[model samples]
Target chain A: MTAQIASSRVQRSSDMLAAPSLDSILALTAPGMECVNAVILTHMQSDIPLIPALAGHLISGGGKRMRPMLTVAGAELVGYAGEHQYKLAAAVEFIHTATLLHDDVVDGSDLRRGKAAANIIYGNPATVLVGDFLFSRAFQLMVGAQNLRVLDILATASAVIAEGEVDQLTAQRKVETTEAHYLDIIAAKTAALFAAACRVAAVVADRPAQEEQALDDYGRYLGVAFQLVDDAIDYDSEAAEMGKGKGDDFRDGKMTLPVILAYAAGDEEERQFWRDAIAGFLNSDEDLERAVTIIARHGTVAATRQRAEEYAQKAIAALSIFPPSPIRVAMEEAALFAVARRY
Target chain B: MTAQIASSRVQRSSDMLAAPSLDSILALTAPGMECVNAVILTHMQSDIPLIPALAGHLISGGGKRMRPMLTVAGAELVGYAGEHQYKLAAAVEFIHTATLLHDDVVDGSDLRRGKAAANIIYGNPATVLVGDFLFSRAFQLMVGAQNLRVLDILATASAVIAEGEVDQLTAQRKVETTEAHYLDIIAAKTAALFAAACRVAAVVADRPAQEEQALDDYGRYLGVAFQLVDDAIDYDSEAAEMGKGKGDDFRDGKMTLPVILAYAAGDEEERQFWRDAIAGFLNSDEDLERAVTIIARHGTVAATRQRAEEYAQKAIAALSIFPPSPIRVAMEEAALFAVARRY
Candidate 1:
């Protein structure tokens, strides 16, 4: 009971630092959640000297450890009080980190979260291998859970995420890339983990089937909204405003949401620029400026944000089946803030 | 029943091409095993135009698909009868391909199996992404198995393999790389999956615990033997006979098993050569030859082969626990041949 009170105090302190909606959900999470999270966080980092050097550069860069948080939070919501949540938390983080590592490699990204990308610092081989290491470790931890439902969810998500990445790779430059294709890829690659994270929480808690489906839906929509906003911010904000420093997605000729929308609205010349020059390389600062101008003209930036909002609203709607609780309320608001955040 | 007989016949035919002991186990696997092998053979080839062009050059150049073959053979030994075995066979191949992709990237090797590597042909980015794609696909197929044991084994193997690769990266030129260190790295990078493959076969069959453990032991020892032989072959075989291979480990200064063995043997001149030239770079053919002469004089090549043989023997011993079936017999022989094969 003393432990529970101490955890609550910690949660309250952390909640104060988060967004309003996040604060509420953060509060609702069980007192033991921190113990699980701490266990996961400690184990997730590599003990290998070089591995730690590279990972230190990453873990310090700071994305909201949201996926793992979801796992822990959902488990708590489902009434699970066991230590398995820690293992699940580590497992989820591993998968997430693996994807990020690969994404950097694929993009040849120089920076992530305002630091040098792993590939940039350690080279592609090390980055890729480390990513693989994280993936394998994640599985080891998940297996420790010894829950078929959790295993199935994670495995399926892992595969779908890869397929989604592949789809993005193939579809990135093509004008024929559709909304459906984008949604499909996002659902597989991004949302699947989010869905699985929440659903597994329910599995751990032994929650009712309907409640599990609701949480799964909530996570799926939340992931979609998060991605949509991510894509939107790339085009809408400048380096100074967005910590990303520069929008490389446009420069890289990626057919992100803004590009998709712009392509839909623009003329043959615009399409030709994308195909010949921008798609291949950004020739100069002028090319970037022109690309931005074209995206603005297409109303893609606003449209993308609106779509993100729709997804967030849908995420909130999914929580309707759950009985009213501070955590559920917080989840509803966090979905909105996820897209609304500056960075 | 007819399908099973047909598969057995096919296996027998393939086994006829190998050593006598391997032939018997080939006849014991279920009909679906062939289907799994087929999937592996088909998907293992890269479809990226340049990737395939390079892979075809390599595959046709005749590197044995030893890993995939081991996977299928292990499934047979365990009396696995499901269609999922075929998917697993493909999954194992994907994992193997991913490692090879990363290996080429790290080694910066132009040739593998005889032909140009994927990285050499398509560049590092393409190779890395394709490797990621294969890994994700492997995970996906494993998920379809809905077997937690299989997932756990494969996942853990993947992580260990990555760690081994990374360990090699740092320890490349260092003479301090001990036999234990070498074993640790290779066990994770190479043998873990081999063991996992056989163990998963037992898992799919829901075999007895002791039988499963035996199969896993066989795989672990077989993988160790196979890697030891491969490392030894780098020293003993002619470049031409070894398929576009060069004694590049010495030239590039990787502290492989033979080098470690020779270094530990305490030849002052050989140690100096390793420190000065092999640890740096072989400047000329003379340097390469000198290094080779030192290794030969140290009897390291013979010692390494002896170690490989010991592992193979141990692998054979592991199979004593299994029932006296033709499949089990073939499995035992295959483990021996894994070390004994010249190329």
Candidate 2:
């Protein structure tokens, strides 16, 4: 391997340390999961060279492989020693990555996971088509799971995610966006997949109805918490550490949790700053800094974190319906840790 | 309705005459097909306002609705009177329209079917997202058809189309693009959906083995024929009548069949004109006109049309397995007309 590949592997190893170590959770994974993993690796092929290049560039960017891990973890938690869960896990990851591709294009974002986005390097058209390729490939992988319920849950989730994205585009810069509206958008855009990820695992495991519902609830709450923290980090993280300019939410005119909280707090000067900066009445680094300062002053980040904590608690509570297992415990811990992690 | 809407409606009526009148097609439609149509209309909804706006624009834009018609016709051709065909038909149209939406975005096209393209009016992001929304919804609708085979076929076709599109993007502005490469791209990007559409209809209809293969062949050949004509018309059509501006293939650096033929036949001066105009070396209207003149001089358009006719004949020949019916005859005629009418 090249020096760069070696360094990347080392970096990935370090990033893995940031999460609650999954050693105990991974122990329950059977040999069948490996088979599913192999299937996933084989099926990601694209006949077009540029597509595989773009896909490789994005996949090798070294984020925590949390979503796919969750799939395997969820299945293990349900005592599923079957091969299908691994495929489902990989399918969920592909779908997640596909959404990111489109999301970057839609937001015109240049950075993701501290690397230049695929759209930035390959242009929007290639990004969009490769995203579509991944979506189709993901669906193909899911079909291999051969479970109707999993298919239904996933297909619906895919539809809602697309709808949520379109909703987010229209809702941008709209200060009147209510908590209900925010929930709807986040549910569609983020939580749907997380919920489906867990539900599909339970489904392939052939879990009973009530247990399946509980897993879904846990996944949904975890996803909402994850996204809430993510939105908060967009404003709160330092520019260098975040690998992008700070206050991206404001720069993009997105009404994320912190901005929404600050708006609801109704500090007159803060409201004025937002009205000017995010509403396009002001355009300067000063306006952006002022807006971030106002959000900080109102303790919006703290409130967002508190909201995330509530979701994490709800996720842990939902797990009570499942039988005791190391994987389950790790999932509960992961939900808490997801909110606790920093850039 | 205003004069434009009235005229558009009249034009739609006349265009229907160019094939079979819509009324005749509807009158002969089996009861099973009516079910498919109803399901298709119900599933196209999105919570986002922009999606609906884009949909209205696309639905109103007067393409022949030939793809969906083929899907419905394919189902009926194989003695299928089932409810799933309509969902499949709608699914095919959704996939086709979704591609068109993305194509306009990638091609930087301003007009499609004689009106402002969706991207031009709604902005590229909205158009792209809405296109994605339609695609996901298409799969969801196909899933509702409850045939795993149909689901798999459509999913694979969607991937092929996306891959082919990426190939086109990478190959654009390259004068060395071969006829084989051009055919491969078009077959995947355009004809794959048509093949899948017909194949799914057969699968849902539970047709005999021979009939299924025959219909699949018919759909594939017809799709290739349709696309060839579309490509040929771009080299020399009357822009006012086609609603698509002429020389679009060259202007966009799209290496379609006519350009490939022109390259094979042109002298040094003509070849240089193509090389400069199409290879991004020059991009002026004068250059565009010169390129068009050279291609016409080489009978590239005629050669392309001949290839299209051959595909149409192949498509018609594939339907020999079907018993005689007016609907079957109309479908055969439609295949021939797909090439003959446009070019």
Candidate 3:
């Protein structure tokens, strides 16, 4: 059955030149998305005005809500008809937002999602503390779901996400970071939550283990493809498209997959340039331009896109276990959209 | 029944000059505490060596483990014979440690528990991420307890604690902060966790709501007394004794009870001195001495200790409903010790 699904998905990808956009996918889950937004607004309340204010600043900043959309879409695809998915979707978004707040502080980045980061506006102490509040709120939402398995998935996912973040920190600024290590970091940091978000839909719908594992795989592959495209876009897109400045990963000395691939495939002179750039030696617009030229010359960006497309196809294949439906088609298209989107 | 307990507790406090020390209290709950220590060491484990290494550096830095001791003692006082209390105790410690790590980074402190702060040695990003990992680990531990009520209590307490920390930030350097505001902050920040820790024992043991309320009250009052004493010690104790520098609160312009009292009661000139000191104008050791002298002249430290004794007595009074046993006596003594401890 899996082999059949793989061949069918590959054939479908070749037939369909462009996947459905994020707006269309979100439109498929509009009602569920509205419920999640309501829950988010309600839970963000506190007697301490600063919490709701800062949280509002971030939540209203026009995030794509991609993770929560996956959660809602996953539930619909799995035939979950209950209201618990709304709370769980809100929970997933809360976890994601909490991490963004902390990530901004960790990276000392001034902007997030096309606005001044919360830490920049409210200061680090408020951002960190509010991040903690949102995290606790996320757990509260999970507990309200009243399903032990769902709780286990999310709680374990939270830990792995943190570890992945720490792993990324450990690997930062080191030109020697292998592609395998880079994959591990993104799998843990980004894909774990995505996997859990989808797997939880199966648990909520009381599906069998096979279905649960399939959904988890789908989300995991989709998440990897999404991050790969994000990293690639960091090199290729403008600040308006990427939400932050272009070449942010480069300036921050982040060891993304493209850099790792290019560094491994480069000549001695090229490798020296890569090493100096990652070590904080490269600083000007010209340096960034040259760096981009080198990356483009080696075709790493194209290669990176090809790798992302592979994961996107795998993600679509994972959905073959489910029968055809509007929700399932939307989820499959969402996977393709993840890799194909420029931003 | 409540009045009788309150009267008896007042009589006991006057009759006993010196309360049992923390050492004696820990010895009483030594077996349960040993179990908690084991769980802590186990949960702190990770494939990432940096995590366990940094967590160990802080965990083994000689914290009194007073919070977890309260959990064990609370369980013992309620006659809980099950082992879930050990896991809950460890969870409480994890939450506490996670907050300490974040607090150090938020405050930009160079030291914690008489050692170099985790951020100082490991860097801010690592400390923040590790703190996140520990917090996620804490939720996992709570889920292992398998009681929704226990989950509810800890989860609510975690949010309240973060809210309280933010409230403190809002109150920082504002000399006009009222005493009522300070009490609310400490009660939410410190006492909420203490209260929840003790209350979870009742939940785990399947005790009645009345008993749960009593234990929560006991922990709440004890936590307040402990924090009040800590604030007082900042103005009176040596750096080595307090595990951080002397006048650390004063230097940070923290609005503690001592500063609140002194500022409220001082003459205009003294108020001006306080206004300058708390605004970061006071810089030298001599300035701290004068600040202490001003506080002492108004007897604020002594008054603060007296207020702490009131809360300590209330903590003991709340525990009187529990049957008189070694654990009960030790818990009552622990209340007195909370206020009386010099360090």
* Model 3 error, position B319 (Å): 0.9
lDDT of 3 by residue, A1-343 (tens): 2556545544554545555555546667888899999999999999999999998999888998888888898888888879899889899999999999999899998888778889999999899999999999998898888887788789889999999999999888899998888888999999999999899988989999999999999999998998888888877633236677677789888989778888988999989988998888986788888888888887787788899999999999999999976567668778878877777
**Best-fitting candidate, scored by lDDT:** 3
Write the residue-wise lDDT of candidate 2 on A192-305 in tens digits. Answer: 999998888889989898878998998899999998988877767342356444566677777788888888897677677777666777657777777667777888887888
Error in Å for residue B342 of model 3 = 0.6
Taking chain B only, the TM-score of every model is 0.86, 0.89, 0.94
TM-scores for every candidate against the unseen true structure: 0.85, 0.91, 0.95
Candidate 3: regions farther than 4 A off = A1-16, A237-240, B1-16, B237-240
For model 1, fnat equals 0.55
- Candidates sorted on DockQ, descending: 3, 2, 1
Q: Which residue pairs collide in model 2, if any?
A: B36-B86
Q: Between prediction 1 and prediction 2, which has the larger TM-score?
A: 2
**lDDT string, candidate 2, B1-343, tens digits:** 2456434444444454356334434444545455655765577666677777787688657666677777787876777766788888888888888889888888889888878888889888888888877888787887788888888888899999999999999999998899999999999998998888888878998878888788889989989988998888887644234766566776788899998989988888878877887778777777777777787788888898899889988998998878766566667667767776653
lDDT of 1 by residue, B89-190 (tens): 678877887788778877788888777777777676566656765676677677777787888788878877887888888777787888998888788778
